[model samples]
Target chain A: MLIIGEKINSTRQRINRALISKDSHYIQQVAVDQVANGAQVLDVNCGINIKNEPELMSWLVRIVQEKVKVSLVIDSPNPDALEAGLKVHQGSAIVNSITAEKNRYEKILPLVKKYQAKVIALTIDEKGMPRTARERFDLAKKLVKVTAEHGIPAKDVYIDSLVHPVSTEPQQVTEFLEALRLIKTLPDVQTICGLSNVSFGLPNRSLLNATFVAMVLCSGLDAAIIDPTDKSIRSAIKAAEALLNRDQYCASYIAAHRESKL
Target chain B: MIDPKQIAENLINGQAPKVKELVEQALKDGLTPGQILKEGLIEGMNVVGTRFKANEFYIPEVLVAARAMHAGMDILKPLLAKSGDKPTVKFMIGTVKGDLHDIGKNLVGMMMEGAGFEVIDVGIDVSPEKFVEAVKEKKPHVVGMSALLTTTMPSIKTSIEALKSAGVRDKTKILIGGAPITENFAQEVGADGYAPDAASAVDKARELLQQR
Candidate 1:
């Protein structure tokens, strides 16, 4: 599974404040925590709230990458910001997202192709985020198809089936699952989630999120926006994968356990 | 001609129309809209949540299910409202100041409403003073604050401090949360409670009310 450390993003208040203030120390600390905790890929979204964004993202990317060896997930809503980010990354990175919107695809895909980076694809369009699961799923299919036509393989794309909370819409959980199942049925299309999204409002959220991770693994999710530092979640994934037969004889789990001295 | 179960399945599969069709059919078949909502739509969501917690569902499936549930809710809201059924709880929520992120806050608000709470949302970039103002005006039993950044986490502390200083902190139990917040942090802030995510927030709120 692809663990995209979401900690490096500037959307979080500390990161945003740090970016606005140009606090390299703070940025480096977050990058360090995300990697040491276990993020295979660090999503660097320099989207500062109430601060400078483009230059900040670039500056952050440079500093955060130095703190860890994990591949970067260059995250930005703006195409220009993404492009700017790509110029600084040392190796193949993952572009945090792409929607089916014509402008998004037109603006972003070239950079993906240029850097040979993977991408997180959202199933929405210029009209905005769809209100229904089918709308989002169908949008994903179309986005995958269109992007594929541009020589970007579907395998290089990670589909984010935006999960809303169950307490609201109630069916959001089910709808996102259906979309995931369908995506799994597709050839070469990978699946991920902004894992934090599922627990958006409930209490003891990590428990629910950990449980949700198991579910996503069941539905063939290949990546996630998550905190690798959380042991409950990481351990849950290992156990779930073993149950799903994704882990051959639980070798990886055993190895991880031994590494942790557990 | 749509089966409610099929609608439930489709909703889980992210087919909103199918769920709506089933809801309408259930309604036309003399089933109370509330019955269709609780049995067909809400019940399906519960299953999705349980499944999600068990690792049997993924984000796409969960989202599609939410969409499907929404399609059905659209048909039931007026009917449910007209029926005069009392909502389960009342809540006020927002993301802490210096933070513009709202998806998590919105999700929590939506879920609280879904879980039967009448949610009063203050939206993003909110200060503790705003929280105090909302509490003074709405008098909700619980106030939920969200922060997506660690730097803004201090703002959560500041909000709690503001709540305490306003002397209204006792009037409304403050529930602090966000990606960076820990239970330890919540206690340090003098908040009445802390929840890590939207769904657990509902459970915790319920637990808090029960304790009170």
Candidate 2:
């Protein structure tokens, strides 16, 4: 699975305080820490309330890129902020989101094509969050079609079958898994989600999140946004990958154990 | 008659909107606000808390249930205030000095609030002096401190000392928690109690109040 580290977001109070204080060293440390913990990609969000988002996004991109060579997921709801990060990014980055809402494709797809970046398409539209698997599949299909029209390859698009908090709707996990299975049937389109969303508002969230990584693998999910530094999550991911036959002879798993021991 | 039991069931299921609607409906049906609050919302959260203690409900479930309970509380708070009904239990909480990790702390505060405590949140990276000041002003029944980093765990001890110096150590129960904190460490730091997670924190607060 592609592990996108999620610790740098401004939603986190520490990161938010750090960003507000222009604490570059703190930001750099978090960036380095996430990469060191096995994140292949880092998800950066400037949070929702910060003013001067475009500038902050650019600054964050520069600082993180300075400390690490891992690919970035420039996460934002604003097209201008996405463009700002793209301008500063040294390589092909992933646009963390664009929904199926009308006018989103027109605003964000151009940036993806111009920058040659992958995009995460949220399975939501003007009608609001899709409550059923059929709605999710239909929205994901629309996302693939729209991005393809923008000259982006099918593989460059990641369908995020949004995970609703299961406590609110008991069937939410099942609905999301079913949606992911349907989205996987699309030609070459990848599927991903913020795996933590499923366990939101619950106790012992890490256990639930770790279990979700294993479940999503069977549902054709190729990536997740999570705290890669969490040992339980890391162990679960390694074990799940091994159990699923993705870790070839358990070489990586054995190596991981050996490294931890040392 | 609007069934308050239905509200409790909805809250346990994490149905915030439904809980809100049902609470409004119950009020419209002339059910006492106190009855709706205690028997309906608090009763539901008690079940959630019990399930959480048993590891049957995880963080997400507790959060959603808390949110659902909050929906009912939002309706009752103003009415309760007008009627001059204050929560019997009070707690002041913060992440320890140099520790900006508050997700765990916030969870504990929410659970405490759901259990009918008046929680005064001091936010993250709170200094010892600041904690002393809050203790003096808030005069809470309990004080809770959280630290996620091992390096910052000593702040719990330092803050407790500050409380002792301020002549308020015996006035309240001091509880400590976080990723790195343990019951042994809590003893070393002279804290009255330690809860590994948010659910137990609520129960601990209740027990501390009983001791008081």
Candidate 3:
């Protein structure tokens, strides 16, 4: 039930525009609107194309935290930028990721261990992803065991079960759901899914995606890669939790409704 | 009794090679995906999300972890799909006219899917006429509109106007968002709801649909 806001990343057109033009005002608003609408974490991606990622990450962190009390998810693929952002982080934070690739781990995990920050672990490895649930689960456990050697506990890590575009294989969806159900049982782990990847190349994708999310939670996914900007999907999660008895006494449901009329 | 903290640390330090293997090992050893996800994965992401909200996890990290989680789901999705399950509800969404921004729209779309709702994304640059047409054809319980520009923000209003004109507005709930959008704007434009971020979007969508 943790909502990590995905806006404010430089990959988006507007943020990219803001980065290109050095438009601090527009960048600040991305922080503003997302926070106002109830984003607990503002994700800051300075874009792979930008030159000054560290400085931008620092600046974005300062601006967003200034506006709201929410934590920041400083995301980037560059190890240098991720570390640079980590250097300036004022409070508790999550390191966006660590993968099974040796280079990825060699580059990323030490920082996470150094900072004791929570990390997102992808099930993929050096070559690519496994084709079956058994292989996937094996990799996830390997990550847990390997990271434990670094003194980071398994509980501190989150496993991202990747969601591939459905356009490639219809049966993959079925495979995905099965893995999701099984993933919930991993020792001291949380399962997060990048929800958008499923509909890539399909028509009327949003609907297909929303429907898919509702179906997956039966496996008890912990977090999602989602826009804090979309209400329909948010509404769906809240409603499902309430109806499914995940939210005791419907407290979250009522609060969600009330907070918005604001 | 679950220690989300320890699990999170193991993940951060690369104790696990991949989240999927960790999950399966947990299952074989009698741990549940729900337990692992909640105590470890979810708990760890909570740490990540909290840091994200606090400006601690930078863009690369979020993207990386998001990629990681996407990787994990490649293992998890099929299992969940056939777990003798059913979708909680159904909704349709699309980007409003004159706007090509879709990352946000797409994220929300996926969250809904994760939450077990039927979501239809009509793609970017969707028009009001298209909105009405889809509503009629799909007969969805809810409709979502996205606009990233103040200039294009009007398309959200216009789409609703189209829905109202088509007399199908009342039959479906409408939600709105984008950079220039706000709660007041959502109301003014006649949307029943608005989500500021993708996580809450799923929460909102769930609440609204359940109300009906």
Candidate 4:
């Protein structure tokens, strides 16, 4: 599975303080740790602190790239910050999101085309988040069509079958999985989600998240934005991969346990 | 005759508008408002609570079902009041100081409301003094606290200490929950009980009420 490390985001107090202090060592260590813990992509966000977003985005990209070889996912609500990160990133990056909203697509797609970056397409529109899998599927179809219109290939699009917390709605997980399954059926369109979303408002969040990860993987999730250093998620993903035969002969699982001294 | 059982079914299915209409129709059918309150809204929410505790239902399900039950309550509240009826228990809840996390608290609040308790939400980042002030003002039967961060978990004890000093500690049962909290921590903080989730929080609150 493709793991996008989510720990570097500034919403986390430590990361936020690190960013404010220009603590490159802390940021770099987090990036290195994520890569060491199996992150293939590092999701970089300046958090809700938007005052110096463009500068912080570039600084984060440069600092993380210095210590790690993984590609970056430029996560920002602002297109300018995303553009800043894309420009500073060493290789082609993944634009961490765009939605089915016309304004968002129009603003972000040109940058994707310019940067030649992979894109995470959220199945949402001006009407806000879709509550059902069918609605999400329809939005996914629209997203693919719109991205294709921008000359981006279907393979380059990662459909985020948005996972609302199951604690808030019992059927949200089922709907999200169903959307993911449907998205997988579309040729070359990959599926991804924020792994912790399933457990929000619930107790023992790690257990819920780990179990949901295994379940979504079975439902055809291609990647996830999550805390790569979380032991429960790490173990769950490795075990699920082995059980699903995605890890050939359990080599990855065995290697992981050996490396972690487990 | 509008069946109260159908009201329960509508609530389970999260049909708020239908539940509202059915509740009004039942009242029009000459049913006692108390009977509608007990057999319809409360019964429906009881099923939701049980399902939630069993993990058969999740947060969104409980929220919607509660809203449906509220719809039934809206029509019944005044009538039940005219008949001198009221939910016997009152719950006061909040996230502890330095903790902005309210989702867990909100869930517990919602579940408490669904289970026919009057819930007073004290909001997030509440200090010990603030909690004491609320206890003094609301005089709630139960005071529930939550904290998602380990950093803020100690505030639960602080709040409890404040309540004790205010002499209202014995007046209300204190319940604690959050990601970093355990039953042992709850006891350590001098809480009456600890709940693992929203559904269990309701059960725990009821148990505390019974003890009181």
lDDT of 2 by residue, B42-89 (tens): 889888988887878777677888899999999999998887786877
Q: How many residue pairs clash in each candidate?
A: 40, 10, 168, 5
lDDT of 3 by residue, A1-262 (tens): 6777787766466786787677878877877787666567767777434358777777777766767777677687568777887777767777777778777787888888887777888787755666677667777888887788777887788787667666544566777777766777877787777777687545566676677667766667777767767776677778777777888999988998888721
Q: Model 4, range B96-157, lDDT digits (tens) per residue?
A: 98666667888788778777788999998899999999999999999999987545677899
TM-score of 4: 0.63
- The list of candidate 4 runs beyond 4 A from truth reads B1-76, B80-212
Chain A TM-score, candidate 1?
A: 0.92
Of candidates 2 and 1, the better by TM-score: 2
Instruction: Name the candidate that leads on TM-score.
Output: 4
Query: Model 2 clash tally?
Result: 10
Cα lDDT tens digits for candidate 2, A132-215: 899999999999999998999999999998886665567878998999899899999999899776776567888988898889
Docking class of 3: incorrect
In angstroms, give how far residue A183 of model 3 lies from its true place: 2.4
Candidate 3: where is the Cα deviation over 4 Å?
Answer: A258-262, B1-212
Please report how far candidate 4 places residue B151 from its true position, in Å. Answer: 26
In Å, residue A172's CA in model 1 sits off its true spot by 1.2
